[model samples]
Target: MRIRSVVDVKTSLGESPVWDVEQQRLYWVDSMDGRVFRAAADGTGLETWDVRRKIGSLALTANGDGAVVALDDGLYRFDFAADRVELLAAPEKDVPSNRLNDGKADSRGRFVVGSMDTLEASPSGRLYRLDPDGSLHVLDDGITCSNGPCWSPDESTFYFADTWTGDIWAYDYDIATGNATNRRVFATVDTADGGACDGMTVDADGFLWQAHVYGGKIHRYAPDGTLDRTLDMPVRKVTSVMFGGVDLDVLFVTSMARPPLPRFPEDGPQRGALFAVDGLGVHGLPAHRFGA
Candidate 1:
């Protein structure tokens, strides 16, 4: 498969690339710019949704009416038709240093989100599960940059990433009780750059695909945590990946332009761009949003 640039988003911190199967559109957020974008399946007809603050991630509801967004300060229900947003609840209001980051809906439609320090400071982040009925559950704690709470196809396993630690951990997932057990290291990255795993997705074949921030590539792993394939990217900071297209053969990747110390040239071609790769035959399940 060959990687090609689909569009130049110019997002300072592009993250959470999700495919809306029903609408045949791709949705994503510019976390630092506080912008949400939607484009046709072919990367055309792009439209921007301006939000009040940085949006971490978004999920379509079970009924496909609208989306539930994890904003910088709290959770909100977004009415796409009305273009309005209503606050649900703030799980981390007391922790002023932290902000909502990666999140997605579970198999049962419950939204799970993680919080991390905006300034990349101490390891005070935590993962929370927000049920449809508004009950909140703390799943894990003491993380610096929480990312990628992706689940297996059967909902029997969960994969989470602590970006600061450069470790991806796996857990035995119980969908019925919403409990995670057997925490073990699934993958680990080098300490030189501390390049950690970011957003991830499970394919129809049960393999996990993860984007590596500062690692300059996306790694595909077998179910048993063995390396499958690696797709090299021009950008240094890849944030997320998702499978889209009618047959789910196309892989969509989102990247950020910034690096830690010396940044890339402003005119570089690969930074903040949406990319696509063909020939991958793994299909992804539709995302479920919070109900109204």
Candidate 2:
């Protein structure tokens, strides 16, 4: 019920927000700045790496030595010790105008990611799934700006958002085969109210909590896509959310400090800082690590 900024670091376009329960650390990305960050649950022991390319998302590897990241060009293996990346796959080599955007690992440990048209002028982006064995499969397409990829508690439903269209879609997910099908609209953000759905996480109770970028709020939706409630935020560009802390009860949120457009106004001083919501009386599922 109480929201407070937990980190002293601010980012240009903060996103992702992944929590590693085993290590008791939180990892996040500053997309526009192409930076990856790690810190303890209390915001101590902070470390950062400049990947030199726009990074869309990050997923922890089971071995804890490296991470799998969605860079502007493709999926790469990020080595924490060496601070370098090795290309894993570039599914969109032909689509030079598009870049990988939002992604997360399924409960089965396969990474699911979506690309976006950098210009936001065409549906040139596509969704991809990277299996642990190093095979990449295209699942969906016709996306302009991709964001918010997560799954339900039962692992039956996969959720993703196309920021340009303001629609969040749900898919019939096959945990065994790592397939996503039966795509349908799960929810839509009324941009007239001033933002698109950016990132999301499902609570332990199966409710979807989404960050409304530019609207400065988080929307909680029931399993059937009914709006359960909304929590206003102090910053306008709330980018993503995750659950962390000792018991995984705290809701960790990331935001953006950069202005939306070239000449647009900037947000408050706390815009790109990481914030934690405590006392929600709810917990969340642990983030799945890359199986390989």
Best by TM-score: 2
Candidate 2 lDDT by residue in tens digits, 1-292:
8999988577988999999887899999999899999999889899999999999999988775788999988899999999889999989888898889899998777999999998777999999999999999999998998888889999999999888687789999999999999999998777886677889999999999999988899889999998898998889889899989989899999998885467434688898999999988989889998874
Worst 10 residues of 1 by lDDT: 258-267
Residue-level lDDT for 68 in candidate 2: 93
In candidate 2, which residue ranges exceed 4 Å CA deviation?
Answer: 263-265
Tell me the whole-model lDDT of each prediction, alpha carbons only.
0.82, 0.89
Candidate 1 regions exceeding 4 Å error are: 191-194, 259-267
lDDT of 1 at 150: 87
**lDDT tens readout by residue for model 1, 1-292:** 6788887877887899888777889999898888888997678999888886988898877664578889989988887777889888898999998899999888687888898887666888888888888788989999888898888889899999987787788999898877888989987755465456889988888889999877778889889888788877877778899888887778888887654235322325688898888876567766555542
Residue pairs with backbone atoms closer than 3 Å in model 1 (clashes):
60-289, 61-289
The per-residue C-alpha lDDT of model 1 at residue 279 equals: 70
Q: Return the lDDT, model 2, position 214.
A: 84
Model 1, residue 255: displacement in angstroms?
0.9
Best by lDDT: 2
